[model samples]
Target: MRISGPTDRRGVTAPAAGRWSAGRARPRVLFLATSYPVYEGAAEGVFVARLAESLIPFVRVLVLAPCPPAAAKRSPRARGRKRVRVVCLRYAPARLRLLAQGPGGIPASLARRPWLWVLVPALLWAMFVGARRALRGACLLHAHWAVCGAVGGLAARLRGRPVVTTLRGEDVNRAARSFVHRLVLRACVALSSRVVVVSEALAQRVRRLVQAADPIVIPNGVGPEFFELDPPSRGDHFEVLFIGSLIPRKRPDLLVEALRTVPGARLTLLGDGPERPHLESMARAEGLSRRVRFMGQVAPERVLEYLSSAEAVVVSSEREGRPNALLEAMAAGRAVVVSDFDGAAEVVEDGVSGLMFPRGDADALAARLRSLQEDPAMVRRLGQAARARMRSLGLRWEDTAARYARLYEELLSEHGGAAGEDGMERGGRNGAA
Candidate 1:
């Protein structure tokens, strides 16, 4: 695929023109993700949508995602994101959506409350139906999480489309916990044309599950705006930031514990989830109520403002898939103290870019915090190094989209073209152009 200059009707400017075979048309990508941005202020799955949007200029992309059934009442949040056409399929009833598809994402929803398993069947069935309807003119399928990958795999098998499944952290990490989970994970791997993971650690885990499956590691990226390099706005007291859902896996409580060891340090928690109340209470119990600020759920565009203002960012997660929170912080030139979770080593270099402590070790984390506190110059140096590393790596959404576009072309070449009803290959026509 050659990069050609052209802007599509969707308002996304194509950096390069993409090609399949010599005579084929531009490929069309249908993305399947259980979590996607439904409205403008939605904090969930904005990364998934960003990938789809980036691909729009390179290919025709249509996103088939499930929104809470009640979201129909709100105005569309996709005003500026005109690159991809999003179809929000409803899986649960309005009142039952919170129980079935909680804000913590599908896997976390089920893990936290096992009783919600009752609604899974309906969710999968709905996705299957939606995928079938959306696959009519699409040439390839890209599923974000394993659960959605399972649904996409089934639909692809029926429709004869090549499906690529991207495994984000919990989808594979917790797959072995139950029979259904394992079965779904296997189905996703078995049906995929290629498997993609955000981190090398996750790729190793997938190989252990399916020896034949070799997953490609493509780490998530940060936007250039986040890397604008504003002067450090160190306030009277050190301000640290934590941006993620307050779930058990994220270990926000551990960050709270570490904060107890550092005096005169303030924290800003910038996301909400099921565990917010418990975390809030824990903060209060430790007399950290004044130092901790819970700025629950801000819009995606505003994250850079918080990152630029903070002296450091903390990622104390039990697990991760190359967290965007850490990536954004690094790009914004902020010092970091991240738990050495599964994918942590790939992103942060200890003492080079930032510090990495063993997962769940509050004392180790506190010690690192103390080091940064004692020397403000060290914090500035580390933040600058982190940004420099990110710059050298070229971690941006544009680069990510180009990689995906090439992968789609490779899969398209193997498949020849869209399949006819009789399982015959037809001339490769991307979309209804």
Candidate 2:
């Protein structure tokens, strides 16, 4: 139950003592994502790509993720998997457009349509039949979410490799209300010798949900080099942007309603989900569609471009485990207007770096929005404060990798070379499609 170090006092540094042999003899580490850098996606791929960059110099890496099943049965775009060879799994159906735009990927969406359970089992079986061997050579297995960790933990146990699981947003934040999901996640957390969560709130939540589930709280990081302060350019409209999935929890409708009080100002949304069509309908109903533009979904590379060109990025999520989108937005020097979720409040200070409103209160949200929009000087001051706040936090990609690497080493020490946690790696027996 111990992790490597806090690293704040030590500063970000590589492991100089544990040097590996030269040439092709690097310590091999296997990174697992139920879905990897699917060429297109959200936080999962973003975190994976960043982790890959951090771990490459330290270990020989192989990123294992889901690829399309058979081309004929998959979408033409899903065939994009032909590009990478180091990946180890592919169970995505022919119907998926891509990983991000995939119709049934998100947890809330998956919870609504139970039939997709078929895909989970099919994926587990495929990973078993396909991945058991490669894992034997792997130093450790690191999964992005509990489900992905369930798959990886089970596989790693079968192959006798150390396994680590990360408690991502929906997986840990919303676990309390979902009985079946909590059971499965508990099993994964129990089996995982080490579990990592982004926020202290989420870490405590996981501890309450699972037995012996002592999770390490490592707040997500933004590459300092990438998201520096790029002060707003002149002639830019007082634009406020909301970038997240169009789901109920995100509360984008609140953004639409907030527009009622902020006259002549423009609001932009940059994602798609179950609520998109309804949200669009609501926007037109309010006549604010004239001021709001739904960008549907945009590429990750283009995300910073959008943030760079805006005034502030607003967050309206009902719940969060430290959103990757907001950090990126803040790192880009844009002020934030987040919903009054505890997680959001944890990061933003009122009238300081950013502002927050009571959950679902459109009026309060609009007032905050209007305040930032009308006063350019206030916006500039807040943006500068936000940038300075983040810069002082001691977060970077190298810190994140070192934290996970240390936790893995600690988990190995506690669990020993014998058998590991039980239920998580037992997925094969858990019924199939």
Candidate 3:
């Protein structure tokens, strides 16, 4: 990693061909994301990093994201190993960075530390400045969330560039709950050249927020890395896996409650969040401190290992755009039980590739878990079917990245044509080309 500009303090060197050029106008894209993997192999928003990596071969991608204050001590190698360049802007003080708005998403972070609200202006200003600096001679901008989209859209508008925004789960479900957030998000959607959502359910929500909003449905793709590893054989004890932030929406507490009904069943949670202590206390109260294991946060590769070892994977999120956990588990040949909310039904077919239960229903969830435990053959069959379904869907990261590349090309063509028309308008009297 080498420094390039004043604002470009951190960067990851890409492939020989993907490096920045000062003489030629290569098709470049600026990505605005608030949540990204901070540490090496950190589990936070690894999908964002994966998508950025996948897009590197197609275009010169530069990511402008917020770095958690506490991550000032991050190892040099923790940035990433890909063609995409990332510059993390620190908005909070060093000691307070851990409480800043980055990790468990803006909603959860704000909930954890309300005083951080004072830093919102600084955070947005930092992103604005970073986006302005990164957008020099860039053809397109793609923001990962509504907030980022709003900020990045302003920067792109200033540069007269086309901007696209992807409304992943929380941007619509959590942030959109607030009146001010809805207003800002609607403005962002209005400014976006294209609005992309991971699921049709989210597209519908976007339409409600902005009546004229017509969002394209682009599901998140599973990477080939997850498919390369084979799952370990199931054991005698019924073991299930839950891999996501332990937030209220994730409903890990309900998963623990369901385990109480299933007697000897074990649940291993593989991510950390603000809700961990409360969830642990709930599990202890139910006398399940022994069966429920909180693995905290693990490396991205270890997630696949845990998925490979488990008999089934459960996604108990009350609201989601598209959970990588569900998709990765499906791709890894493991039976999945997802909550019947948000986009769960879009990816899962009940009694087919996986099972879907009503959210917050511990009894229903326990019944489904017990059924799989009683019939190991059904578990294996479901898992096999899930793997096949994922393959048939053709949800590969390479393909997903190519689709965005096509979109970027279209935007660049539009921009070029617009510029040409404006030039002719300015010098039509002189017959200028």
Against the reference, the lDDT scores of all candidates come to: 0.79, 0.66, 0.75
> Model 3 clash pairs?
69-97
For residues 1-433, write the lDDT of model 3, one tens digit per residue. Answer: 1112122112222222333344323355678888777556566677877787776554556667777654567652233244456677777676666533344777788888798788788888988888877777456789988888898899889878789898887778754578887877887887789989988899988888778899998778897877765754657668899998877888888898899888768889998888899989988899999989999888887887787679989988888888888888999889999889876777889999999999999899999999998888889889888889888877777666666766665766677632222211121121110
Q: After superposition, how far is residue 234 of candidate 2 from its true place, in Å?
A: 5.7
lDDT of 2: 0.66
Q: What C-alpha lDDT, on a 0 to 100 scale, does residue 389 get in candidate 2?
A: 74
Using TM-score as the measure, the top candidate is 1
How well is each residue in 190-272 modelled by candidate 1, as lDDT tens digits?
88888999989999988887677889987777888888968476678788889999888899888788899999888899998
Best lDDT goes to which candidate? 1
Positional deviation of 293 in candidate 1, in angstroms? 0.6
Q: What are the models' TM-scores?
A: 0.90, 0.83, 0.88
- Model 3 root mean square deviation, Cα atoms: 8.1
List the candidate 3 regions with Cα displacement exceeding 4 Å.
1-25, 77-82, 99-103, 417-433
Task: Single out the weakest 10-residue window by summed lDDT for candidate 3.
Answer: 424-433
The digit string of per-residue lDDT tens for model 2 on 96-153 reads: 4133224225464465565666666676676565556667655567777887677677
**TM-score, prediction 2:** 0.83
**Given candidate 3, what's the lDDT at residue 339?**
89
